[model samples]
Target: MTATAPRPETSGPPALPPLAAQVERLVALGVLDAAGLDAARVHDAVQAVDAPGLLVVDRGLVPASVLTPLLRLGDRAGFVVEDMTDVDAFAPTDGLDVPPSPVYVVTAPDRGDDLGNWSPEEALPELAARGRSPLLLTEGLHWALQVPEVVERNFCYMTIGSRLRKADGAYDARTPAVWISLGTGRDGRERRGAPKVGWCWWRNRHTWLGFASGVDRLAVPLDG
Candidate 1:
């Protein structure tokens, strides 16, 4: 994730923005909210079209069909578009292995009070030692529905495929946990200088869980 500074300022035209820019454009257009969920559309599209977004592929429909419509909307609205729905779309960064497939984990911090299936004692310290303040739940926030006493020591594991991450990378199963600091997570306030190891995702009924990545792969996309 560590790349040296710029080679030189380009006198030529600027580069195209990354896919995130288009996503922002979508937000401004009411296609999605600041949280990135196309609520009304997700409901409408799912019912009427039977896909969250779609393209009439041949005579059938595709799953997670939001990509095409977004691309078309980006073009129609005059913005650069890129497909970033998956890790395969991003230009790889060194040591940026995928985090483990997220599970519906409802856990609380291990404050010497015996509770929860997972009890991570070293992950937060390691990340802190590396000067990384991973995202966390705001104190007094009941987002995870964790019982009052055992709330907020949230950590997520990494994955290689649909299975779990079994590689001997720096963040393997042995040392596979990452931290979650306090903040307005869905508001995108967590983005900044440090590399984005992973992200937090949840629904009204789901626990506020996150993915932890070791590599930093952030390239600002254009608004075009």
Candidate 2:
């Protein structure tokens, strides 16, 4: 009998952007309100969380814990982490304005591939825990069929991606989730041949797909 060849191992470590570098890029985009940053905390977060894996969306309150680790990085970039809760509940929200730049990693909290993997049911509760009521949002192309719960929230979301298509020219349902930023994107879209939105250069890409109930726009008020 002929011996069978073994299959290659699939999946590897996530290639998330470097924390310090990503913070700098955000400053260049002019989204973060990098001022009066608690420098002490930024230093601490950088010292504590060294790996990119620690920042990717996962089952934990990393946002609350790790959000301030880059105060110096952000302060230098001219963007400060506001006292707002909702926008940064799921991910770090840069800038200090209503609807401040929300950095959504299309990478699911459980998986690392694309945004489609996450459903409203799975992500909403966490947002609520953080006191957010923004409409569940994602890439507009697959909105209607994928996340119908968007009607329950106030505003839609817009994010960037590179892993939605497959060899068969259909949506790659099995594809992993990716991390997105309603606020600022990563440093290498062209390098990876990713399909960015029309003339997008930063991570603060707030293109809402829907809204409702006296909510005229996507707003992230700083009540804290």
Candidate 3:
């Protein structure tokens, strides 16, 4: 088998919106309402942790179950794969301490395009070696929501930092990812170009899907 060449960064990381603007985006998406969270309180919390970071709403406030369908890229809305009805079941793997707060920030996030064609099992150690952490599924969604350009044709990413732990204590092999729908299969013709929350097997690799990662996470202090 021929070895595939590594891909380059799709482009420089697109600039993220101001933290305040990002909070309002959540409001616009009805995330606040769906989460039963007050927009003002959410806004204030984000303000306290404001910095050059990607604002992410922890699954506690709004489950991936709810947020996936609310994602928008251009005229199309986001969706979870029909087979992935248990999307919320996936959680941060052991040792990946996602903040307990409802809103937090991921600093210096990147779509690891250079790691394209590498399987999730292959990429995790590389990310740790680089002193970076893999992004959670929701963090990837937050990045796309704040900067839609991160997701496009021929360039999308995986969020393998999370995995589903079965009742037997073995982790499910399906890893979550965010990408553009091809408008084929169960996606329906109209969903082409829409953002999609889906999954891939831990050992599988796709030439176009890269792993997403970040330098660190900055949690807003829980006690205000």
Give the candidate number with the greatest lDDT.
Answer: 3
lDDT of 3 at 143: 87
| lDDT for each candidate structure | 0.23, 0.26, 0.84
On TM-score, the leading prediction is 3
Cα lDDT of model 3 by residue, 1-224, tens digit: 22556555356557888888988998898877877777888777776774678888778777787877777888999999899999988889988978777778899888988787888998999899999999999888888877888886667999988899999999998999999998999999999989999999999989888899998788865444
Query: Tens-digit lDDT track for model 2 on 43-107?
Result: 33444342331111121312222322222211221121232223222321232122232332222
TM-score of 2: 0.24
Query: What shift in Å separates residue 11 of candidate 3 from its native position after superposition?
Result: 2.1
Ten contiguous residues minimizing lDDT sum, candidate 1: 53-62
The clash numbers for all candidates, in the given order, read 15, 27, 0
Winner on lDDT (2 vs 3): 3
Distance (Å) between predicted and true CA of 102, model 1? 27
lDDT of 3 at 192: 90
